[model samples]
Structure formats: structure tokens, C-alpha cells
Target chain A: MKVVVDGMGGDNAPYAIVEGAVQAQKEYGIEIVITGPEDLIQKELDKYDYDKSKISILHASEVIGTNEHPAMAIRRKKDSSINKALNLVKNGEADAIISAGSTGAFLTGATLIIGRIKGVLRPALAPIMPGKNGPFMLIDCGANVDCKPKNLEQFALMGKAYFETVMQVNNPSVGLINIGSEEEKGNELTKEAHKLLKEAPINFAGNVEPRDIPLGNVNVLVCDGFVGNTVLKTIEGVAGNIFSVLKEEIYSSFKTKIGGMLLKSVFSKFKKDYDYKEYGGAGFLGVKSICVKAHGSSDAKALKNAIRQAKVFYDNRVIETITEYIENSIADNDENIKAE
Target chain B: MKVVVDGMGGDNAPYAIVEGAVQAQKEYGIEIVITGPEDLIQKELDKYDYDKSKISILHASEVIGTNEHPAMAIRRKKDSSINKALNLVKNGEADAIISAGSTGAFLTGATLIIGRIKGVLRPALAPIMPGKNGPFMLIDCGANVDCKPKNLEQFALMGKAYFETVMQVNNPSVGLINIGSEEEKGNELTKEAHKLLKEAPINFAGNVEPRDIPLGNVNVLVCDGFVGNTVLKTIEGVAGNIFSVLKEEIYSSFKTKIGGMLLKSVFSKFKKDYDYKEYGGAGFLGVKSICVKAHGSSDAKALKNAIRQAKVFYDNRVIETITEYIENSIADNDENIKAE
Candidate 1:
């Protein structure tokens, strides 16, 4: 199986991305296809060599920057690295497409370019992270921020399938993230979504609070993009902001600095506890293949790990399982929609 | 000013709550009135006394537990400790009431017993938490889980008043906690609330995500109870769960166990953080008098800190300021509603 890597995607493009692809091919024995400017990709490829036959490059002239609008870029830059990489997956040239560049561009390009599953309402981005319980999937983390009740029900269906097939959790428990656990709580969208999810043909875990994320309360978590994004970003912001504060405190005085030295190893371990990059990377759930979205600041190690995760995702045939789940769920999903 | 303490409230009832009240009286030079079984309150009070004249015990027989239904208890136990304490505030026998019992019971009694201000749509519970910019208040944390656009607009007004009084900032920046920063990114309630707050007579900073909370992006955060509660609990859960996992890892092996011993002091500092009790309790906003809600598991220190916060609330005349703000906000709020 060949893995398509966006050579122009991410902050350290052409260098870290190229180096990461080479490391994965060498270590994991996977065929790699790198997409970007052919000349720049060659210069980076010259830095690494075990077998030139193990890796290939696809030429693309344009690169999407961080500030570029995702929809606009996808529309205008049809031959961009991200689009070229996705095209490889669409034509079955590659088993998956991975990118660390603009999330919007990847999401927009993946759906509008590569296409969505037949019964899928909207393709969601599901990323699993270390929750209070263990690893839990947060659906629509940033995709479709303003969701309708029907959209949330669809998110739950997609998330349940992904968790069960990819994560191998049987009858994966699906929870609607509400502000409170009570039935009458949440805004209009959530209030209606709660009723819809309960009636769907899935293991509904009822309502879950944001705090429950860390506790690993359920296998699949569903929410509108706005709330899900807030939860994911809050976890990141709280973890990052606190660590930064602690660093300032640890070096604020001479005695504390000395104390910080004696406690350096523990602090390093503490930093690892809250680091999302340490847990591989995020998955773009609704895509046909095993495409994953690595963090923009992903290093070589994280990228390699993400590549391995994508291989496992492909081997699991997650798309086939999701298709079956969707087919089985149509009657119930439609019933809930009509009922609500 | 006299502060009424519910002696039968909290986990370590009569002891911690009573002792905390006695300490407040002696240390802060405030008159204290303890409400509970006369005998138990007197017994706890007898443990310390710098001035009996400064402290008084009011008799009440009923008790409220953390698990009890708050509204039912408020209605059934009219002479309960919470109601009795609130009566003291209502009758001008005490300037404020402090209870660590059921939040529902306190809020119910505070609303029905002490009553709401004229034209105040809902009484929001504002909790001041540490943020990036400093301490910011999350209004209506759980007082009302479901809210309308008008309710949130009024919450913003009350939050601004709270900051001016207790937080003491000139026109504290108010932000709505939403999934995205865009006006149309939220569902019906949030979208309408955005329009209302933007036009309200206050300094509105627009929408803020959960990540912004840690960065201290906004001073007074207004959101319906569901979103606010989810954000509050998620932070609480993450803080507790992450620390515990790291602690377990440190003690999992013999070598790491020894490392844990040498790292005890540093770990203690780390532990000091994840401790939610350290951040003084949440305040009940929009009440006629200042009221602080401590965690159910609060010890003496937590209770003491909560009381200290109440002192600031009382001195600032937060309720009076809210009254003025709400009175001024009605016209703009109505116009916003009509425009929507």
C-alpha cells in the first residue's frame, strides 16, 4: 500500500515533512509518495537514502499557507500539494492522504474533491485524544461549527462507526456532549439532538459533560463543532497555559530555579502527560481512506507514528465497517429525523 | 456587617463550616451568626472564642445533604438550615448567607426566599476562575442550564455589574463563550444572544472559545448554564484526572517510587495546582446579598477563602450595581430582540 504525504503541507514543509516521510518508509517498510514542488522535494530527498525505489514524488506547483482560506484555496489551487495528494487517494493511487497544513483546506478538499460516503450527511473530523478515562473520540472537533439537530445525529452515527471499526470497540458507546447531564438542559440544537441520538440504532450513552472527556467515560463523543472545538481547544489551552505558567514560576527566583533543577525529570514527564502530539495525531474521520491530520508543529517522531496509525486504519477496513453501520442505521436515523 | 453561616451545611458540617465562620469573625472583625441545631453550632463555637459578643447562634433543626433534591428540600424544609440562613439575610438580620450544601437548595431558597431584583430575568451564579489575563467570571455556571437570548443578554449585564463591583475593573470586557468567534457560528440561542450583547449598553468583546478562558481573553463570560457548566467541569476534571494519572505512574515501579519520594515537595507544588478547592468558591450573582458557594468537599481553608471572597462581594455592593445595570440594559436588549 502506498501512503501519499503532502510535502508542502505544515509549518516545516519540504524539510520536516520530507524527512518524516523518509523516516516512515525506512522504519515501517511502507511505499511513500510525496507531493509538492518536484525540485524542492528532490533537494529534501537528497538528504536521505536507503532505497530511491522505496519513495516517489508527485509534482505540484502551489502550496497552501497557514493564512490561506481553505475553501478559496481548494477552489483556486486545484493543482496544489494538498489537492494532488487527495487526488491520489480518489483514484486509488494511494491508500491514504495525510496533511498537516490548513485544516479547512484538507477538510474542504477531502469532501468536495475526494467525496463523502453515500449515506453520510456531512463528513466529520474525528480526533481521538487522551481523555480523563483514556483515549476518546471527539467528533466534529472543528468541522461544521454551526450544526443542525439532524447534523448532530449524523455526527453520532459516523463517530460510532469509526470508533467501532478503527478503534475496535464493539457497539461503541456514543454520547451527546451537553452542558449538563439532565434531560431538559442545553440549547435548541442539543435539546433536539439528544432525543434524536437516543432513538438511533447505536449504543447511546445519554448526555455527557465536558469534564467527563478526561475520564474516558465513553467510546464515541458527539457534539456540534462549536462545542466540540471549544472542548478540544480548552483542554489544549488549559494544559499549555498552565505548563507555561509553571515554567515561569519555576524560574521566578533563585531558590525556585534550584528547586526546578532537582525536579527537572518529573517536570519533563509532566509535560508529556498533557502533550497531544505525543499521542500520534488526529484523524480525518469521514474520508474514504485512512487519511490522518497531523499537528502543524509535528516533528519527525510524531509524523512516523501517525503514518503507522494510518496503516493500521487501512488494514482494519474502517470504510467497509462504516458503510455497513450506515446501511443498518438508515431506518432508525431517518425515523429520528422525522420524529424530531 | 453580619454574615450568616449555615452550620448544618457542607461535608464536615457544624465543625468546618462553624469553625470557618468563627475564624472569619475573629480574624476579619465581622459579626457572625451560625444557623443550625443550636447545640451542635454552640459546641463547635465553644472550641474557639475571642469575643462571644461578635458571634451569635440562631436555632434551626433541619439539614440538607449534597444528594437531596434542592427544590423539593427548599419547599419541604422551610425551617431548614439553608432557608433559615437565607431568612437572616432577607430580614436584615444578616448581610449575607454562606452555604456549602446543595447548590440547587441554596439557589432555590435564594430565589424564592430572598427573591430576585426588579426586572432581573434570572439570577446568575458567577464563579471567578483564574484565566490568562488574570481572574475572569463565568456567569450562570449552573443556575439556569437552559437560557434564551434575553436571559443571556441580562446575564451579560449582571456580569458587567459583578466585575465593576467585585472584580473592580473599569468596563470589564464581556465575551460570550461560543464554539467559534463568528456571530453566526452558534445555534439559535447563542446567535441571538450575540446580537443582543453586541448592542447592549456595555463593553462587549464578542465571542470567545474555551481556549480563551485560560488566556484570560474576557473578563465577564456570559453563556447559558449548559455551556458554562461544561467548560467549568471540563477544567475541573482535566486538572484532577491528569495529576492522578501522573501520580499513579510515578508510584507504579520501585525506581519511580524512590523518585517520587525525592520529588515529594515538587509533586506537592504540582498537587497544589489541580486542587480546585484552592481557588475560593463560586459566587451566587444577582442575589440581593452576597453569597458564595464552596465545593461540597471543602475543608476549613476553602470555606475561609470563600468567606474572604464574600467580603469583597459585600464591600463592592455587587447586587446594587447589578440592579442599576439591568435597569439600563432593558431598552437596548428589547431593541436587539426586536431586530433579531
Candidate 2:
């Protein structure tokens, strides 16, 4: 499968992205198409010894800044690396595309340029986060800020499909992130979404409180982008603060310092488990083509893992499965309406 | 100062609650009225040695369970310990009230029985959470589920008053909790609230992203109940999960076990810094009288701390400050409208 890489994306653009693409090609033996300034990409790729035929470059001069307005950037920067890369998938020239650039620009380009899948209300960014029991998917992490009850229903279906196919979890349970577990215990949006989710075809686990999220209570946790974003960021903030505080405490005393040294290996292992790099990228679900948005601060290792994730998404036919799921659900709704 | 304690409220009710009252009475030299079944409260009170005049018992025949509906329990359980304790404050027999009962019941009873401060739109639960820099108050943590822009504007005013008066942080900055920091960002409620906050009579800081909360970016963080509740619970979940996982890892090996034992003091200090017991309880702001909701799992130490907090709240005249703040803001709005 051919995977197109945005050569000018992310904070470590060209250097890290190019190296990661080369590494993925050498390791996975997949054909790679890098999009950016031909000379810059080639220079970065030349630093490593690899099969020349396995990797190719498509020249694109303009690069979208992370601070640029998302929709405006996508529309204005026609020859940007992300735009050019998304075009490859739109025209069926590549199986998938990976970008670590501006999340907004990438998600906007994937939706407007490549278009949404038929019957999909809106595309969602689903990221699998590490939990105590295992990893679970938080859909619409920041794709659609404001959503309707029906939109959440679609997110549940799409997230369930993606988790079941890409992650290979059977009959993955889906839950609506809410303040309380009771059916009548939420704001307007969740109270309505709760009813719709219960009727949807997925294995609907009742409302999942944010406190239970870390326990991996469900395989797929669905919520509007606003609440999902808050939950995701709060977890990051608390975890980072704790680790930093621990480090300071460990160095405050000689005894604790020696203890910290002895426990260094265990700490490193635990950090790796919670590291976002190991999870690769968040998939832009409900899009017509496979699109993965990697962390902006990703290094070569993170980029390589994201590329591997994109390849798996293509191989497992996640987009196709989501499409069928939405279409079938729509048909069932129509039949029920006719009977009524 | 006289404070009323719900002697049958928390998980360790009667025992922890009674002992804590005696401790508070002895340490602070404040009059305390314990509300619960006379025999049960008397039995627990007999275990503690204290000045007879400082501590007294108010016999109540009923108790409210944590699982019962908040409003329903407040209305039906007329003779409950929480109800009797609240009545003591309402009737001016006590200066404040402390309860470790169901949060909903306490909040509902405080708002309905004790009443709201004049011109106050809604009452909020403002909890002083420990952060990296220090402590910050998160207003409307789980009170009003859905709110308008005007309600958030009031929350900001009330939160600022509480922070400045009780916490003694001069002109504490107020920030609207949002998904993004930009003025144009966030959902309908936050966007409008941002505009109102700018015009409101307070030290209005711009929008605060959830990720910055743990760093104590602002002294007062305001949001609707749903989002605030989600953020609070997510922090708790993430912090608890990390510690649990670290413990499991520490015990998995002999070297780490020795390290854990040596570093136990440092770890315990860190835990104490983040512990809710040390912070006392969440103050129910915008109420006519002081009401502190202690943690449901509070032990004797936590209950004592909560009593101390209630006494401080009453001494500082927080309710009077918030009432004046709201009334003046309303008058200012009226004058502005008249000028327009």
C-alpha cells in the first residue's frame, strides 16, 4: 500500500517527517510518497541509506503554519504540503495520508478537500488513550466543537467501527461521556444523546462518567468535541503536573534521590506505557479516505508509528466498515418509520 | 462562633462526625451543635473529652442516605440530620453548617432552606483545589447543569468575592473555563460569557484552557456545572489512576520495593499536598448563610478541617460581600442601560 506523508508537517518538519517516512519504508517495506519541497525532502532522505525506489517525493512549495485559520488555510494554500498530500488520497493515488501539522488544517482539508463519507453527519477525530485496564477511543476529541444528538449517534457508530476493525476488539462497547450515569442526569445534549445511543445498533454501554474513563469502562467513549477536548486536556495536565512534582520531590533529599535512581527503570517503563507516541495518531473518522493526524511535537519514532497506524487503517478497511454501518443504520431507521 | 454539624451524614457518620465536633470545639473554642439521633450521637460523643459547655447535641429522628434524590430527600426527610443542621443556620441559632452527606441534598437544602443571597441568580459550589502554583477555586462545580451567559457572569462575581474574602487573594483573577483561550473560541455559553465577563465588574482574565487549570493559571475558574464537573472528575480520575499504577509497579520488583520504602515520606508529603482533607470542604457560594460540603468519605480529621473552614467563612462575612457585589453589579447594569 502507498502512504503519502506530509513532508513539511509538524514542529520537526522535513527532518523528522522525512526520516520517519524513510524508516517506515525500510522497516515496513511499504511504498512512500513524500509531499513538500523536492530538494529539502531529498536532502533529508539522503542522510540515510535506503532503497531509492521505495520512496518518492512530490514537490509542494507552500506550507501551512500551525497558527493559520483552519478552513481559510486549507482553501488558500492550494499547493501546501497537506493539501497536496490529501489530494493523493482523494484521487485514489494513495491508500492513506499522515500529517503532524496544524490539526485544524489537516482535519479541515480532509473533510472539505477529500469530502465526507456518504450518510456521515460529520467527521470525528478518534484517539485511543491508555487506561488502567487497556486503551479506549475518545471520539470527536476536537473535530466538531458543537454537536447535535444525532451527530453523537453517528460518532458512536463510527468510533465503534474503527475500534472493532483497527484495534480488533470484538463487539466493542460504546458509551456517552456524561456527568452522571443515570439516564436523566445530564445537560440537554447528553440527555438526548443517551436515548439515541441506546437505540443505535452498537453495543451501547450506559452513560460513562468522566471519573470512570480511566478505568477503561468502555472500548469507545463518545462525546461532543467540546467536552471530549476538556477531558483529554485535563488528563494530560494532571498527569504531567504529577510527574513533574515527583521529579522535584525526588531531588529534594539525598535518600529520595538514591531511591529515585533505583526506581528509574520502573519509572521509564511506566512513562512509556502512558506515552502518546506509542499510540501513534488520532484517526479522522467519517472521512471518505483514511487520514491520520499525528501529534505536532512528534519525533521520528512517533512519526514512524503514526505511519504504521495509517497502513493498518488502510489494510483493515475501517473507512469501508464505517460507511456500511452508517448506511445500514439509515436504512433501518427508514424501515422503522415506514412501519410506524 | 457556633457551627452546626450533621452528625449522621458521611460514611463514618456519628463516630467521625461526633469526634470531629469535639475536636473542633476544643481546638477552636467554638460552640458546636451536633444533629442526629440523641442516643447514637451521645454514645459517640462520650468517647471524646471536651468542655461540656462548648459542645451540645440536637436530637434528630431521621437520616438521609447518599443515594437518595437530592431535592426529594430535602423535601421529604424533614427531620433528617442535614435538615436539622441547616435549620439551625437558617434560624440564626448557628453561624454556619457543615455536612458530609449527599452533595446534592446538601446543595439543594442550602439553596431552598437557607435561601439565596438577594440578586444572586444561582448558588455555586466553589471548591479550592490544590494546584502546582497554589490553590484555585472552581465555581459551579456541579450545581447548575445548564446555565446562561448571565449566570456565568454572576458565578464569576461570586467566585471572585469568595476567593478575595476567604482565601485573601487580593483582586484574584477570574477566568471563564473554555476549550480555547481565544475570545472567538468555545461554545455559545462561554463565548457570550467571555464578553459579559469583560464588561462585568471584576478582575476578568481571558479564557482559560482546561490544560492550564492544574498549573493554577487563574484564581477563579468559572463554567457551567456540566463542564466544571467533568473537569473536576477527570483530574481526580487521572491522579488516582497514576498513583495506583505507580504502586503496582513499585511492588512488582524487589529493588523498587526498597526504593518505595525509602521514598515513602516524600510520597506521603505529596499526597497530603493534594489531599481534599487538608483543603477542608467546598463552600456553597451565593447562599444566604455559610454551608460547607465535606467529602462523603471524610474521616474525623477531614470533618474537623471542614468545621474550621466553616468558621472562617462565617468570620470573613463572605455572604455579605457576595450579596453586595451582586446588587452593585445589577445597579451598574441598570445605569448602563439607562445611559444607552
lDDT of 1 by residue, B1-340 (tens): 7888888888888799887877777678888888899988888888885488988888999887766777888888877888899998999888888888888889888988888888887888888887755778888888897688889988888888878877779988999888667666666778999998887887999988777787776898998886788788888777777667767776676656665565556557666655656677888877777788887777887787788878888888888888888776766557778999
Q: Score residue B328 of candidate 2 by CA lDDT.
A: 95
Q: Kindly report, for each predicted structure in the order presented, the TM-score of its chain A compared with the true chain A.
A: 0.93, 0.98
Global lDDT scores for all candidate models: 0.81, 0.91
Can you list the residue pairs that collide in candidate 1? A131-A214, A132-A214, A132-A215, A133-A214, A133-A215, A133-A216, B132-B214, B132-B215, B132-B216, B133-B216
Which 10 residues in a row give candidate 1 chain A its minimum summed lDDT?
A: A255-264
**lDDT assessment of candidate 1:** 0.81
How far is A277's C-alpha from truth in model 1 (Å)? 2.1
| Tens digit per residue, CA lDDT, model 1, A219-290 | 888987767877888888788876786677666766566655655666687677567667766777665677
